[model samples]
Target: NYFSKNPVTGKKVDWYTDFYYPLLNQWAERVRMVTSPDKLIFVEPVPNEFCPTSLAEHQPANMVFAPHWYDLNALFAKAFGDFTVNVQGLSRGMFPLKTFYWGHKGARENYTLQIRNIVEKAHDSLGERPVLLGECGVPMDMNKGEAFETGDFKWQARMMDALITALEQSLIGFTLWNYNPANDDERGDDWNGENFSWFSRGRALPPSLLYYEQDAPSLDNGGRILQSIVRPYAAKTAGIPIHFQYEMNTGTFTYTWVNSTPNPASQTYLKGEKSVFKPPRTGHPALMSLETELFLPSQLAHGRTVIVKGLDPGDKHRYDESRQTLFIVCQDASLDKVHSIVVSLDPPLAPAFAVNDFWGDFGGTITSILVAIAAIVTYFFLL
Candidate 1:
C-alpha cells in the first residue's frame, strides 16, 4: 500500500526508501538549520513502521526516536479484556495469531514486551539515542460508559496502571495521550467519539446525581483515574538508572541506579561556590556525593517507610515534605556498585481501624448514652 509509482520511470518505488526517508532527512535538516543545537528533534515513526536502518545513516545529533503505541483492542472496542494483539511485530510480517496474548498476566506481559522491543529496536537502528513513548493512554468511556454512570473507574485505573507499568519496566519516558479541559462525557474530546483526556468537565457521578445541582461548592472536581496517573518516580538521578518499579496495590516503589561521581564541569556558578576544582585521581574510583532525587507523592508516602541501601556510613536521606521529594546522598565507595531506595507502606502494628470503624464506634457510643439517659428519666417519672 505504501509503494509509489516513479513518475519519471513509470515503475513502482519503495515509498519509505525513495520518498518518505528523503522527506524526513530534508525536514530534519531544515529544522536543524533554524533551531539551536541544544534543541532536540523528535523523529516519529511511520504507522506500523520500525526505525529503518536507512534513517540511522542520516540520524542527527540530539535526536530522539518518538513513537506511539496503544492497545488496539481496547481502543477500537471501547473496552478492555484479557486479550491483546501484538501490534509492533505487524510491520515485520509476523503473524498476529502467533503474537496474541490470552490471560491477564499475558496481556500485561505483552505490553511490557512490546515497549521493550521498541526500545531495543530504536537502539539498534538509531544508535544509543533516547526512545520516548510519545503517546499512550486508554479510552475513559470504556464498557459503554459504565464508569461514568457508576462513578467507579476501577477499569480505567487498571488499564492505565498496566500501561504505565510497562513503560516503567521498559525504562522509557512518555507523555500521556491527553489532558483536555473541554472533554465531556457525551462529546468526549469532541472528535470521533474518542475520550482519552485525563481531565474531563463531565463529572463521573452516580446516575442518581448525574444531573443533580449542588448549592454549595465542592472541592472534588475534574481528574479521572488519579490513583494510577499520579505516581512516584525518579525525578532526577546522579548516575545511570538501572531499574524502577511501583506496585499500586501495595503502594511500594523501588528504584536502583549506579552511583556516579559529580562532574565539576556541569556545575553552574552560584553565590559563594568555588569557580575552579581539581579533577579526581586516576588510580581510584571517585566517591559519589551527588544526591539522587525521587518524586514521592505525599499521598503515597504518608504512611510508608523509606529504606535506602548502599549508602556510606553517616550519609543520610531526607524527604522534603513541601516538595514531596526524597533526596539521597549516595556516597558509595565504588562506582560500579548499585544503590537502591525503597518506599513501602508500613505494616500495621495491630488490627486495622479504618474510617468506617471509627464512625461505627462513635455511633454505638452515642446510642448507649441516649438509652442510659432515657432509662434514668423514666425511673424519676415513676418515683
Candidate 2:
C-alpha cells in the first residue's frame, strides 16, 4: 500500500491523497482568486473526476459536484434499449449487448445503485453541498431510430424515466448531454457517433408531425422523446427533494420533499410547457398566465396543470408554458408550512435528459410568429 505524509498529522495517508487533495486545493486557490464570490467553482478529482473525499482547505465556499455519467452497455450497443426493452432469441445472440446479464433487471439495479453511490460520495466528501449531474443521456441512432421512426418513443422514454427517478431519489440537479438540433448523424457532434443529443435531424419532420421545417424535432423528430425527456421539475426548492416519479404508462407524477430551511423559497419553475403534454383544456391557458410565454397559437401546445397536496389551498401554482417549467409560488413561502408537496400529472409520461454545450441557438420561431400574429389581431380589433 502506497502512502503519503499527512500535512498536519505527520502520519501516513493513502497514495491518492497526495495528488487528489492537493489538486483540489490548488484548483480552489486559482478559481477563488479569479471567480466572483457569487459564482461557484465545481471541482473534479484527477482521472475520473469523481470526488472520493471532502476537499480540504481552499475549496470554494460554494463549490459543487458536477460529474457526467454513461452506461457502458448502452454505449456499446449504440442504442437506448435497456432492461425494460425486450430482445428475443436468435436475434439477441447476434450481439453481446443483448446477453442475459447485460439486459437483465440486475443491470438496471446496478445503474441506479451507481447514481446512489455518486450522491453518497458527494455528501460524504462535501459538507452538505449541492450536487449537479453535469451530463447524462444516450445516443439516438440506437436500433436505427426504430422507436423514433415509428413515433413510439416508449423505449427511450423508459430509459429517461429510470434516469430521472434516480436523480430525484438522490435529490440532485442535472444537465442533459446535448440538444444540437443540427446534429448530423454521420458525424455526431462533429466528433464521433456518440449522438446523445435530445434534438437531432436524423429524420425530417413529417406532415403528420407537429413541428415546422425549421423546428428541430427531438431525437430523430420523435415528439414523445422530447415530451418524456423535458417535463416539469423543481428548479428552486424550499427543501431537499425526497422522492419524485412520473409514470408515463399511467400519466401520473408524484413529488415529495422535506423542508430544510425556514426562509421562504423563491419561485419554482417547471419548464418546457410549449411542447410538453397539456391536459385537456379549452381556452388559451398560457396567455392567461404572467409566468408563461405568449406563444404563437399554432406553436402553443395545450398547457398542463397538476393536482397539489400539502400546499396551502390559497398558494398560486401554474404551469408556465412559455418558459417550459412549472411554478409553485406561495404567499407564505415559508419552509415550515410548505415542506412537502405532491404534484399529480394529469397524463404524465414519467420523466425527462441533455446535450449541447450551448442552449441559445435553437430557434423557437413559433414564438416570433405568434408575436406578429398577436399584433395583427390587436390592429384588426382596433380597426
lDDT of 2 by residue, 131-166 (tens): 778878766667676754575655566566666656
Q: Estimate candidate 2's alpha-carbon lDDT, on a 0 to 1 scale.
A: 0.52
Per-candidate TM-scores read: 0.74, 0.59
Q: How far out, in Å, is residue 291 in model 2?
A: 14
Candidate 2's TM-score: 0.59
Cα error, residue 339 of model 2, in Å, equals 4.4
For model 2, the superposed segments whose C-alpha errors exceed 4 Å read: 1-28, 31-38, 46-50, 57-61, 77-110, 143-154, 204-224, 261-305, 310-339, 345-383
Best by lDDT: 1
Error of 1 at 179 (Å): 0.5
